[model samples]
Target: MTRTRSTWSLDSMPDQSGRTVVITGANSGLGAVTARELSARGAAVVLACRDMSKGEQVTSSLPGAEVVRLDLASLESVREAADEIRGRHERIDLLVNNAGLMMTPRGVTQDGFELQVGTNHLGHFALTGLLLDRLLVTPGSRVVTVTSLAHRWGGGVLDFDNLQAERGYDSMGAYGRSKLTNLLFTHELQRRLAEARAQTIAVAAHPGLSRTSLARYLPLPVRPFIAAGTWVTGQSAAKGALPTLRAATDPTAVGSAFYGPSGPGETRGRPVAVGSSSGSRDPEAMRRLWEISEELTGVRPRFVPASAG
Candidate 1:
């Protein structure tokens, strides 16, 4: 876990023998690869997925892996999953907020929030809050959220008044806003953790343009081009997962840090510390979004007052 290498890869990662990791949407795509690699490195991995059967299928072959049902679209399910996880483990070394929705047609979650924002941001937001106590008690715990390059889409705009897409809905626009929210949450959470002087830290990573099931909702006319583009420019799910793995495991990675592919435009390559959109780094916007998220999720993180800092 020491920081000695200039370039990080799977082989450079230190042994994770006693670490416990929980990852959402871990039965497929980047999540699955992340789970497999960590488990292979001797970490006890928990696959938190919407489909228990598929999670079981993935966990069966991974010796120390376990499955837990988790539907990020439903707050109730998130609560249940958190409760189950909290009951089962006294400490959570890492929590990967990897599950998300993409450019799907307009829809609402079970909790009445827009589907993209609900599943992509609010769900992870709520889950992190619920499990934070466990993380707080665990030394060196970290929360890694997966964002996207699409965060720069829609001009990096986040309209507070229209969080639920109540005014109008453009699928890609909403998705972009949600990704932006992910960064906001990560930055704000890291701030609060630092203020509290907590042992836990918050970080973020993006897979760049990996070819995953997330693009399944693309328009038919664009599907072929996207598929071809994946072959030409995108990395595989395993390769795309390097940033996440580095963010989650790198001993040198600090709170508010972001990891992503090092290639041109950050589309594909080895993992490295990366910068996010200017919008994502806005302190005022991050604070406002944090307040709104706490109000909507009705779960406030327990942090020592900043005056104590």
Candidate 2:
């Protein structure tokens, strides 16, 4: 089915007068910019970050925003953040699972999994499931997951045996696996939500390689090249936020849809809806990942539809 299309303009975007948007890693870069934009458009925004102090400092100058603590690398933190979010709001209009760590040293999460996969994908997976009820209760609700072009190269084969990369984990490999899982989760979650008669939309988008503080983990020398590449071609974090904003706030957005740039090689340009590879939609792989996710985080059971028969 062809989904409706929504174009994003600072003006044309939804008024969001009464909507509440929760953005992970909202203290900086794309997350921060997204929070600022959503706030500017008159939405109540919850900035979920690892540093409550930074979150508070950042939002102190911005109205219609709140700061809460979240560390995607820690399941306890994720659960605590979920509880905090659930307490203040009965419904959530938008949930932006936008926080991530890039190419960190080989390590495990607070839950004892490889850092990248654990934080980028698993943490958000649990958060989404925990908050699913509120999202379902909220009218016109949507979940926007931010991925990367590296996802094409980063998300490796779905490995059930070495799920955490505990055996010889490569930094970029784990990162790719996590991102590919993002799309897989997006498509599969949408399918399950539909079968359950849930009204929430699930969409995915990539920033198209912008230079942001999120990339600080890269070696200092490489930072120069990345900065040059982004400066030569990358858009500002504020501009890079369009795809997520479009996916989150755009009325035409739908479950399973992907968004990226309208520029050269989709590296930089306006945000527009896009497509994904067949690998991202493999049902068998997605089911395995879903089961593994539940096992790891103790989040909601993978959405079981009436048609599960």
lDDT, candidates in the order shown: 0.91, 0.83
Q: Which lDDT tens digits does candidate 2 get at residues 34-60?
A: 898888888999999998888997798
| Total clashing pairs for each candidate | 0, 4
Show the colliding residue pairs in model 2.
154-176, 155-176, 155-177, 230-234
lDDT of 1: 0.91
TM-score of each: 0.95, 0.92
For model 1, what is the error of residue 77's alpha carbon versus the real structure, in angstroms, after optimal superposition?
0.5
Q: Give the least accurate 10-residue stretch of model 1, judged by summed lDDT.
A: 1-10
Question: Which regions of candidate 2 deviate over 4 angstroms?
Answer: 1-7, 154-157, 301-309
